[model samples]
Target: MDDKMHELEIRIQKLTQVHATDRVRQLISLLIKDIGEKTDASTIRIPCPLTTTDLARMAGTSRETVSHVLQKYKASGKLMIESKIITITDPAFFMR
Candidate 1:
């Protein structure tokens, strides 16, 4: 990988691990939490919502995989989809 990609990977790994890097760990956590609260819940059926396409991009997974997860989530009564808007029916479902 290029230096920039390598650097980003190292940063991500470090953040995922001990989170000792103050700038990356705490700052990113707060920002992400805020985003989760404000993001539209209809897109992916979760309160931390994302459109399938956007999610595909973010997770480095295919749109099909995202759709599959949504379908499974709906089937398990963890989510509700209406007019392409997904509502998180159970907030603690993922914890299980």
Candidate 2:
């Protein structure tokens, strides 16, 4: 019984991680479809009005994780964030 409980715990942890990833993916898709404008075939610009906390709620993830992901996108030059605006320099990056 103890072993079974441990196995179940591990499975739950894995599933939680997967859920978080899925949430982020959903957030990205929503951002793209809801606000993204095509500047060209490969680039999109989004005027994001939502705050990090708002995004977190929308994504069903922690605010820190959302901030971290946004920073990563900024670092990779795939996106830019300024105040309440977000520009997606590489739409292909999110499609993948």
Top candidate on lDDT is 2
lDDT of 2 by residue, 8-49 (tens): 676445435666655665566557876788878777777657
In model 2, what lDDT does residue 83 have?
A: 77
TM-scores, one per candidate: 0.47, 0.69
Q: What's the lDDT of the predicted structure labeled candidate 2?
A: 0.72
Which candidate's TM-score is highest?
2
Clashing pairs in 1: 42-86
lDDT of 2 at 61: 83
Task: Give stretches of model 1 more than 4 Å off.
Answer: 1-50
User: What's the C-alpha lDDT at position 37 in model 2?
Assistant: 86
Lowest-sum lDDT 10-residue window in model 2: 11-20
Show model 2 residue runs off by greater than 4 Å: 1-22
